[model samples]
Target: MFAALSEKHEHKKVLPDLEGAENGVVMRFAPNPSGPLHIGHARAAALNDAYIKQYGGRYILRIEDTDPKRVDPEAYEMVVEDLKWLSLAITDTVTQSDRLHLYYALCTQLIERNGAYVCTCDNEQFKVLKNKKIACPCRDQSLETNLVLWDKMLTHGFKEGEASVRIKTDLNNPDPAMRDFPAFRILDAPAHPKVIAHVYPLMNFSVVADDHLLGVTHVIRGKDHIANTRRQRYIYDHFGWKVPVYRHYGRMGIEGVVLSTSQMRLGINDGTYTGWDDIRLGTLRALARRGISPDAVKNAMLAIGIGDTDISFSWDNLYSENKKIVDPVANRYFFVPDPVTARIEGAQPHTAHAMLHPSDASRGTRTLEFTGTVLIPKNEVLPEVTMLRLKDLFNVKISWDNGMPTFTYAGDSLADARAAKAHIVQWLPAQATVPCTILTQEGEMSGACEPAVRSELGKVIQFERVGFVKIDGVGDDGVVAYFTHK
Candidate 1:
């Protein structure tokens, strides 16, 4: 199930083509409205979007909210925002809660065809009979009786946990789970966010009904849903409907990050994480905060392809890809963390020009007026170092008088600094710097940065020796930025 990658597109790896591409292929990304999409969700979303784009078909974003217990009211819109942020071209949006009547009609049709039955058997007793390859007594009831029981379930004639609608598969099937599965059940406890109801269709049941009704042509999801696919196929076969093509990819593991929605919610409640957009969390909001572009994410997911082997997400690979996209455009500036004043003794006042970007001189440079005093990182002022180059500026010879830093003018030649084995470090003019705080995964690093960064609000820029960061805000209090990646 593989097709060569399109050379005309920006994608990096080959992806499989759909079986019926000329027939206006349709696909859907049906994520339960549990919470906002994390990095894991991006993989499936990206794959579906890529196929839709490649085939010139419709892409539907389906919000599966049938079970009231699992839905997050806020996530109804949060999921859409996440998809938009990722730049997915969704042709339509669907909410399963709004289509309950469709599921009911389909279930009734299945029962009339003897493909399903309204079962009131105790779950434990049914399991025993299913394990023994014996049909439950409810399975043999007349069609009229099943229809009456179905109506009873819908009209609240039967209480929750008293009756359910189950599909009829092979009783002698090796897997007991495949014997007979519940299609719809009664739940009266918690109310749904979008609609009020007692009879709720299970995921497998609603998914099948919607896929067929919505005319979905291809279903691509994680391999974990293999069992669900097998179960859904029974309904399609029973109704004599054409089944959509299926492609199941292996599980993607993102190491050193929390991808589970429940765990993220727990951490947010416990104050372990600042929010979903926290730099430490593996969410799209967090990635956006850190200046990770949607193109980088799409490219990264494409590189992983749809191989069956379980693969781990590589942060280094992602960072490398991001660096390629950001470096050419992100301007460079000097940021001194834990800044300390250095008094220049022999150096005269001079102006220094630092290129906004190393390789792109056409963007111009930032001028720094050095007036015999400069600010450098306190940690970089080692006791052993005798000489160092101030990045784009001249070299300085260091000395300590009464625990205070003093610098003497050294040769401005790069060759001279290299011969002396001096470390080239970033520095800012003491009078030309502004207060800046960089928010990182570890903690906040407060120091001084160039005032020129004020104009770069809401844009990504590099901090010379530190790393790339997105300027989130700038005001009288100074600049606040989120560290992207080195």
Candidate 2:
């Protein structure tokens, strides 16, 4: 798999042509609606979308909800929403539950051809025979008897765990998991949540059948499904169907973040996490809430390509990519955390101007009328500093009288300030300041920002030397912004 990385890297801006492209490329993203999509699933969706767009082919969104025991009806919509959020325009949508009868019909055909059989082996008994590499007694039953048992399975003739329709494979196959795998099994629907059928096709069987029926020319999925691909090949060969081109990508993980849906669901239930969108979580919803752009997520995943070597990255890696994209557009703002009052002596009221974005002057400027008093970050005050430049304003000399620090006009010349090695600090006129709250991954931070921040609600802005933040809302009391990344 890693051999293709060099070719992919060579054409990073273009999606590589899939094998058998002459048939008109078609791809599908099949997601199980068990939980909200995490970053891993997002990568798969993005790759499929990229390929379809590159080839001008069809894309399908297949909801794999066959496992009724784990299906969540609401998650069906959530998957669609997540794909839309990522800007993937799906050509069609499908639900496996709606096609249960098709799967049943296929199973019957396989049983009639002796490609599969209804097995009554209990768990322990099956394990013993499986370890011995011997066929179970049910495997030799007459085709008519197996057909009757299959019908019984559909009508709840056998209880859950008592019967399953297993696809026939070499009993002595080196890989034990590939030996006579179960294609469909009985589920006690009454004990399950919203199960549509007592008999449901397993993932291996359902996926293979659907892929062939849907005319998917390329199947892009995680390398972890390599075993599944081998198991599915049996079904394809039995039906004499063409196997779609398979491209498997390695698992991409964010360092220090757990992407387990089970653990996250448990956390939500136990109040360890507020919800799926909690800042500490890795769900697409959580990343969106933190102001991470969908483009950033897509670009980051695309850069990794479809290699089988697992990749581990850090928050900084994603933030660095986002910063490059957002820095040129995010307007600048002044925010003073733990604000301290400072009075400038020998200073007259003057209007100060700062560009909204340093790189894009066309964005215009933010204007503020300065009074003598201003608010500066309290923690930024340096006892050793004798002079500092109020950024985009005038230079000021610092002095302490009776334990109170004061500022005096030094000069308005930038050249002189630079010669004096004065530190530049951001400040907001006390009267023009508005209360602001910044919600960070750590916690909520209260501060004062320029009044200009009030009108930019829902826009991303850089807080001078702090970080980028998306203004979530504004009110008479203050502005609420979510920290994006530094």
Maximum-lDDT candidate: 1
Question: In candidate 1, which residue pairs clash?
Answer: none
lDDT by residue for model 1 (340-448), tens: 8988778878899999988778899999999988998888898888888998889999887776667898978999999999988889898899999999878899999
Model 2 worst lDDT run, 10 consecutive residues: 2-11
Give all candidate RMSDs, comma-separated.
3.6, 4.3
What global local distance difference test value does model 1 have?
Answer: 0.89
Q: In model 1, which regions exceed 4 Å deviation?
A: 1-11, 400-405
TM-score for each candidate, following the candidate numbering: 0.95, 0.94
> What are the lDDT figures for the candidates, one per model?
0.89, 0.85
lDDT of model 2, residue 331: 90
Give the per-residue lDDT of model 2 (tens digit) for 1-486.
Answer: 334533543435555668777646789999989888988887888888888877778899999888776776678878888888999868989888888899999999999888999999997889789888999999999999999999999998898898999999889889999999999988786443544578889999999889988888899999999999999999888988999999988877675455788898899999998888877888898888777888778777777768888887567766876776677678998988878888889989989989998866888999978889888888767777778888999998989777667789887999989998987888989888999999887789888999989888877889998889988889999998889987
Query: Clashes in candidate 2: how many?
Result: 0
Top TM-score model: 1
Q: What TM-score does prediction 2 earn?
A: 0.94
